[model samples]
Target: MRISTFLLVLILLTSCSEKDKHPYTFYYWKTKLALDQEEKKALDKATAPYLYTRFFDINKVNGRFQPVAVITENKSFDTDKQIVPTVFITNQTFLNISKEEIQFLAENIHHLIEKKIKEYHLNAGQEIQIDCDWTAGTRDDYFSFLKQLKKISHKGVSCTLRLHQVKDKALMGIPPVEKVYLMCYSTSSPLENSDKNSILDVNILKSYLSKLEDYPIKKIEVALPIYSWGIVTNHLGKHKLINALSQNDLKNPNFKKVSDHEIEILKDGFYFGNYLNKGFMIKVEEITNDQLRDVITFLDKKIPEFTIIYYQLDAKFVINQNFKLISKFQGDF
Candidate 1:
């Protein structure tokens, strides 16, 4: 009886220790590597030890695969904070791409990463992450490109996994990487005229994460959304994503409250560089603190060991977030 009781206590202690060890990091996903005073304060408040910075994106332009929106590092990061160079490749880049082209692309990507690291004096060279929403048709080529990149870069490689890829791994196949960052947001397209929040819907998240534990990749990190956007729609059913506009921006006299999550443009001319007509509707989609806590609780039950990476590092969002609530389930950041 005593032995059984001791074993039970040991199990409880082990579980608690594991729960306390949930390390978290941030993803800096901006085209320009510069942080304002507020952003710097947010970083310090979060106590993030490392940042996954986007180096550039690869897209197909005029039938040629090329890097676009390459990051310009205007400011250097703290020496103590590590930076993980990240590259986002569009899935269309792999459509009908040849093996030779894949190899060439991998080589050029590696070279550019090295060049940027050197040029910007960035304290990064350890790990590289690739973000791509690859389909079954392009899976093989994408995996091949990752393999080539891994071989050439000689650094740990990681990739982003969407919800569909997690649930349908058998069909989509997994990428050749050491770790996969499961993106827990962006469940749907913003262009859709649905009432649901495309940034994050708990119902949609639950549907896709049913078999999360059974995912083949053991080392899985989760990225949660901390950003919000305004979906502007006109009478003709046309939609545009005004990323800079948030719920707070709706308080202006130019907008009239339509609903708790929606507003109508009143006598609008130009707002946030977008010309809007009167009567245009805007849907504000954002994740709340309570919703974030619920997601953390749910994920803690599913993933025994994983890191939480906030989708991005933005001052407006990060400064307003309650990190105490965010770190409640997973311990302090």
Candidate 2:
């Protein structure tokens, strides 16, 4: 009897462990649908069930809503992994859009996604994700649009939830979707001149997620930041984001270290195709492996079940870390 009981308990524990394991995924935010050798290797290592590919972005252009940066090349497609076509619509698109316009926009978006899937011969999944940072003013219209989209597309719809949206759901209102992908990065504005890393800050994340456990949305997925950028501040207090810049790139004779994260350009004509003047400040913000682990630990406590989708699959960033380490965070915590 004692041996039987022990075996039963062990079986239950194994079942629970399998249930709690989180699935991993990746987001392809590039305009083209082509993958290099490094990116292909990362995707294979991740073994994600699905890949969220950005189809295009929508914005109001001269009183007309149109799609921009549509995927023009399709050099790669994985038959094993399903593709979730993601559309990014600007919040301003719904600012003053009428009900009739919202309906029309939904139909147009559905048609475009369908056309793309057919044209590219993609192994598209039955779900589509909408990425928008809607405010209170546009909340009602955006929700209505989502409903219209669901009706027209006849597929599972998901949207990206910002940190502020989770904290202020009462004011902003919950989106009309079955699931929401909570974006855990971009805690602060990049244009702001500050010493803190704008990409991912644990304290800032905690402040925004004070009420995460109580958040009504139960089926919540997570997307973490795996990318970084440089905030270039000019002499006149102007700020701009310089992409493809890293801390190692700043370690040069032309630059002087101001702090651990800040650097001053000593003599620069043009670096990385961006002209920099002497005394200009560059703040490098990148997420470390330790920070990623901390974020996973903090989130695991509040949310029981979730799929971790890295913000993007970039060769430049993915090659810097061990594929096994980056893909297996779920089992570690």
Candidate 3:
């Protein structure tokens, strides 16, 4: 009888844990400017009662998340950051990374993190997500890299993938890993007529999402651009990035203008041979705020596994909202 009681209690505990392990959506902060400790705290407070993922603006590495200190160290910036109990996705620009480089890159990442965890004695809470945006053409190499990456990832580390990569892939082969976060940005690119002025068309988005029906939808989190979307290019000539969408053209006077092909560029962003693609730009619409909630609802119906997380709360858009509208849709915040 005592044994039976203990077994029942254990079962109850297990059940409780599973229930608590909810798929969460995070309002992630992405910027090249590192937040000071005080700023981090303020940001944390702003995003409280919801899981917040913070990206340290370190754009130096390939196939790996740049450690928080990479950017902070340069300025002697110190953040006594008790990173909130949430996912922290380090951006690893891996498109240029080659297959042979994968294993070596993963090792460097593993050691850096292992050393940090030991140094800080930090509990990064549940998971660490890696943000990589390699294109479909390089998907196989990416999979190979992750396979090797899993071998090196320290305990409690998982990857955050863009929606396209997760399609036609297996996430579990990476060892000692759990969960995958899905990013749903990059629905369309711009035509060459304008420097940067692409539209996030509803039709384009729906079509892209339709292809990902097989991905593990539950562990998904969409990363939305919170700031006004801007495109920077160099007219494919100068090395420096110029504005793709002109700030002068926005609905606000402060907003710039795009090329004369404004309407066509917004509707379709591709270029023909005569025009040639130079730059494409756009500012994501305010409508997407409500659209996010709607998208989540729609996705939830098709696949019960979606963990809907807002990409960021500290982004300019979130801060600029009218309070009355926010209160009405409490879920957006």
Candidate 4:
């Protein structure tokens, strides 16, 4: 009788551990919402339980905050998986807003999000996530807006927590949200020389984790980057932004591969997203499988309860990855 009772208690403990395991969430951040065959196949293979889809971006235009919608024509998002409509707000939008104005802005944005969710026939109330890199100046207004948003939202609210913000929480103040999604990538500066690995530098990220022990928020969801981009620079060595093009695309005669990181433009013309004279440079930045593993291991040791969220669900990033390794960091694995 004593042996049987002990086995039963062990089984119950194991079951509870399994129940508390965090679910993996993918972020679908494309301006268009339609999933291609490749993306759909990747999603099916991923088996992620949730998707954080970017609904729109809030930008300050003509001194007024406006929601620039990312309208979707196709509504083929998987119904089996939970959907969280994510809103990306520019920090500048909250810089000059009053408390009352912030409240009104929150109300309008929430309504627009609901309208989009209804149009897409997507499930609501799992919880909505907000992505914003708020600065010291805009922290109060932004936090106030979050407070107002939570009051109106039936579901809970989540905010993107940057590394700098995490380190300087005392100065920036805690955002009024239920869950905070800590973005672990983009730790290095883009304007720095090509030597700096901005995507996932373990050295830079470790310093920021020490402060998490004192952070009041218990619930944290971590978003790690699986995507890569190219920083384009002109002849004058000024930095420009461009989506990463395939190696084959850069193989054209107009682009001379000076080095693995440096691409010297052979022709003076418009390219990628910026107009360039000859001798322009494009530096490719990416997170490797090893780097991903390192970050995951470091985070697991420091904050084991944090949920794992891949930056995106697109095939371009997911296809080449060893997700089994990435998911292993989660307790569910």
Clashes of each: 0, 0, 29, 0
- Lowest summed-lDDT stretch of 10 residues in model 3? 324-333
Q: How far is candidate 4 from the true structure (C-alpha RMSD, Å)?
A: 3.8
lDDT by residue for model 1 (82-143), tens: 78899999999999999899999999999999999999888885799999999999999999
TM-score for every candidate vs. truth? 0.91, 0.93, 0.55, 0.86
| Sort order, TM-score high to low | 2, 1, 4, 3
Query: For residues 1-333, what per-residue lDDT tens digits would candidate 3 score against the true structure?
Result: 999999999999986554333333235454332445544453444322444444333344534545453311224323333343232322244556675666776676656555544554543443445555645555556556566756665344455665445543553222223566555555445333333323444445555567555654344444544333333333353222223233334443222445432311332233221222324333322234555554554454444444445445443444444322321232221
How well does candidate 4 score on lDDT at residue 51? 73
Best by TM-score: 2
**Which residue pairs collide in model 2, if any?**
none
Distance from true location, Cα of 331 in model 4, Å:
13
Candidate 1, position 77, lDDT: 52
Of 2 and 4, the candidate ranking higher by lDDT: 2
Q: How does candidate 3 fare on TM-score?
A: 0.55
Query: lDDT per residue, candidate 2, 92-171, as tens digits?
Result: 99988999999999999999999999988888989999999999999999999999999999998999999999989899
Which residue ranges in model 3 land beyond 4 Å of their true spot? 1-69, 73-100, 115-123, 135-137, 166-178, 190-199, 216-218, 231-287, 313-315, 320-333
Residue 316 lDDT in candidate 2: 73
